[model samples]
Target: MRRPTSGCSTGSRRPWNGLGLLLVLLLAGCGGDGGRQTPPPEVGVPPSLREDAGPPVQVVRLDERQAAELSVRTARVRAALAPYTLSLPGEVLPAPDHYAVVSAPISGRVARIYAHEGEAVRPGQVLLELESLEFANLAADYLQARADATYLEERVARLRTLVEKQISPRSTLDKAEADLARARAGVGAAFARLKALGLSDATIEGWSSTDRERPLLPVTAPIGGVIDQHRVDLGRSVTAYDEMLTLIDPARVLVRGFVPPEEAAFVQVGDTVEVGPRSASAHPLTGRIATINPALDEANRAVVVNALMPTREGWPRPGQTVNLRIRTGTPRPVIAVPLAAVTYDGEQPVVFVRTAPATFEKRPITLERIGPEEAVVTAGLADGEEVAVSQVFSLKALSRFEQYAEE
Candidate 1:
């Protein structure tokens, strides 16, 4: 520390005097001039950096224990379900009125068959052609009968002339008359043969012009439907009662079920029913009681019940197995899940109940047959429960999440 010196009235010339006076003041002063303020504490060096406080704040992080304590899923308890109806197992079958078997009408080689198996055919469309020698014989008969009739008329005219002259006997005239009657009868028989041969009048006219012979019957369809089977091939011979093919109109399909004798009593005609697969936007067909087979199966004591389906449009198909929810009893209200939650596992159904934000439990559920989408919860789960309906497969792997975490 340096001592402060006041300038003397008469400035001292000698360096010795100034030095002497400064040394005398330092000796006399208690607090020196330079020692009053310490250097302003080192700039930007924190008091924390100093011993007074600790070091500065650095990185931040979350508490993992708090997150683990939070629940991921939610649910509510439900009551026992009593509102669902009975479901019947059934298969689609062709309706009787819409089914027909097409057969050939004659025994002859099939000249041509244009229709194929499973092909649609319209009524009166030519299915095939069967040709025989009957055409020639019938045409020859018609010609002979017409020629003989012309000859008999000439004879009868001459006979009448002779009778007027009294030269010919009355019995001769009677013979001529009888001959004319026989000729007319022959023409009638010939005409009948032409019709039986299935020759149209126009076809006969063309045949007469070309002097052609060979009976061709165009075996046409009796009803329009898709051919299920074709027995007659091109150039193959077929006879009456020889089935050409079987036809079925798929639009008139039906779902058939066999109701047990006990349940049969409750199922009357015109009862409304629900059907399944439970998929979204899957249109259901309206159905009415078609008929009940009177005889009961001796072994199972089940009676066959056929339900006629409504007009179809790209929905159900024939021979498809379907679950039929027949309303065998009264209706009641119940809690239900979205169509998506329920998944079929063989005969049993299942759903996933969210237990936490990221965890779900595999719960076996029993559903009552109600509607296609809104199925009744007969067993597991409850109302207001959040089920893994969408993105379920993502939850599918969650069942093994703990094992994955360990790995």
Candidate 2:
């Protein structure tokens, strides 16, 4: 063995050189040969076997490395911030400018109907034809009284001519004048009677020449809109107390939001609000608030707010229910992060903010509700900080469900 010392020395030096190279690689972890990644120790690898073995077995802190990788992804969350809140219940109703109920002015049987349900009507348009014996009788009396006045005037003129020629007494001419005045007075009384019965001046004048048109409807719609409800059909008589038809204009719609009494306290007459159709998936239709009810509903403990929607085509119709969100104040710039940025760690909400390219620190925060898409941070955050806004559950699962077993 002493004679072969150089050869033995060379063999021993070769293994030590490889071991030294491996130690450097394991420490730096990159730009190294893939000869062997030391097999991590199996569970229950006894401490007594370590020195006798050729190479020591190793252990990896897998959970610590996994948590770090997950934290890196959570640092990208960004969004608009809002205050914490609860969504209050609400309903859709007709706009005040567009809704109207047509009713009869007087009791009468409807003879003909011009406007049907879903029909559009204008102001002063005739809606129906009515027939009433009371109206017809009044017309007949006026006609007869007019005929009497015409006959009396002729006789009065002849008698006055005779008296003027000394063929009749002065008392006789005065008596003829009195008789004519009485007939004229009767005509005036009858004309006044028809005027009080809702006979338009045009219709009244038309009645004398044409006997065909009679007992017309009151035509009482003062505003224009579409008919929603029909109370009477042809040949059905209705009264003034009965609602004949309901009309609504689409352009003048108002949105009603039933908000909690506490939330409503911050609402003002000019606050902004958003209205969307029942099927609106994400985006909301916008509008300004027109009114806020000061009193709360005793039954629901909520205050009613009316938001005025402008005339926008393809918007929801009147009485069409929708989702409403009332913005209580102006939007101010604040640190806004996605809902996914903050994650629950069993009982506490925590977020991982990026401290370096590969390093992150976990921070806990209190959440505030904005609208549907974003959340505002009430505490534990600053504006424009890089926080994880993605893959929250993955972070929690890796930290909890994927914990490494102790060797």
Candidate 3:
């Protein structure tokens, strides 16, 4: 057997069976490169452990068509003298001296109403007429006192003549004089009472005892205004000092602005203010701050600032809600941008700055103040830089998507 032909002979020719071939492959894999030792399969770096990498810059690139489809608009940043403005909630109100409460001067029943609610009235315009027995009695007393005064005067003159002709004693003339003086005082007292009852001197002077018509107390407007409220109707009874009508002069109106207590110090009398309806599209009226209340409103803890402005017909009617923009300080040069150009990212205010024709870079900024239409930039922007004023939301979305793709 040729030394049993060495069952494990280094074969001159041996066919590789399936099991032998598999064993050879296993040995070669375990030994690897004949002890030259392959580098541990070149371990890859994880994303978290990658070196020399930073957060991707937020940027959005679009073609002209995409921008146009989004209605993107741009405005250039500029150094402008934008006055600091404080916006406040406000109400349209009648000026203090231009508003009045018409009240009954005497206890009476409403005989007639001449002015209706919302009717315009002028000073001295009769608003209503009241039928009062008390007024009639007053008229009667005045007439009687006047008649007595006339009789006493005639008696005094007759007595004077009689005394001068020696037909009457001098004592008689003196007694007549005393009576005339008393009667004159009574007449004066009655006249004062009539005057106190809202009767003008001319009105009293025109009245005569022979007139059989009953006297009606006329209630007149003391100021030019619109009748805002009517509290009495025909035949309604009212007492003295009872409110019967409310009048407000719409032409002389005020904007009562409620400013936050923290910002009160920035407001001053004589500062320019713009008052308008709460709607932004409505035209605004310019005015100056006339007064500021020393105390805060108890309900809202806000300082009350009154602005005096010229009136426009049918606008800014009393009790209408309004917006007040108070220019607190003089205009100073600052980097400014339109309010539409600003947006927020996780509470961080940001703006889309146009770096190229269709490229925008999201930039964080610090704001000194923000007004209704514009904002003052304190940092992160330069004068003459352009920013996206419209379609900023679409740009922000694109920026976020780009960041995701880069990651």
Question: What lDDT does each candidate get?
Answer: 0.66, 0.67, 0.86
Query: Which residue pairs in candidate 3 have backbone atoms (N, alpha carbon, C) closer than 3 angstroms, thus clashing?
Result: none
User: Which candidate, 1 or 2, would have the higher lDDT against the true structure?
Assistant: 2
C-alpha TM-scores of all predictions: 0.47, 0.53, 0.61
Across residues 259-302, which tens digit of lDDT does each residue of candidate 1 receive?
Answer: 76655755767776655543433555656666778889665568
* lDDT, model 1: 0.66
- Residue-pair clashes per candidate: 4, 5, 0
Per-residue lDDT, model 1, residue 106, is: 55
Top candidate, metric lDDT? 3
Sort all candidates by lDDT, best to worst.
3, 2, 1
- Candidate 3 lDDT over residue span 286-352, tens digit each: 9899899999998878999988777888687887899888887524578878888999988878999
Compared with the true structure, model 3 gives a TM-score of 0.61
Worst 10 residues of 1 by lDDT: 54-63
Work out how many backbone clashes candidate 1 has: 4
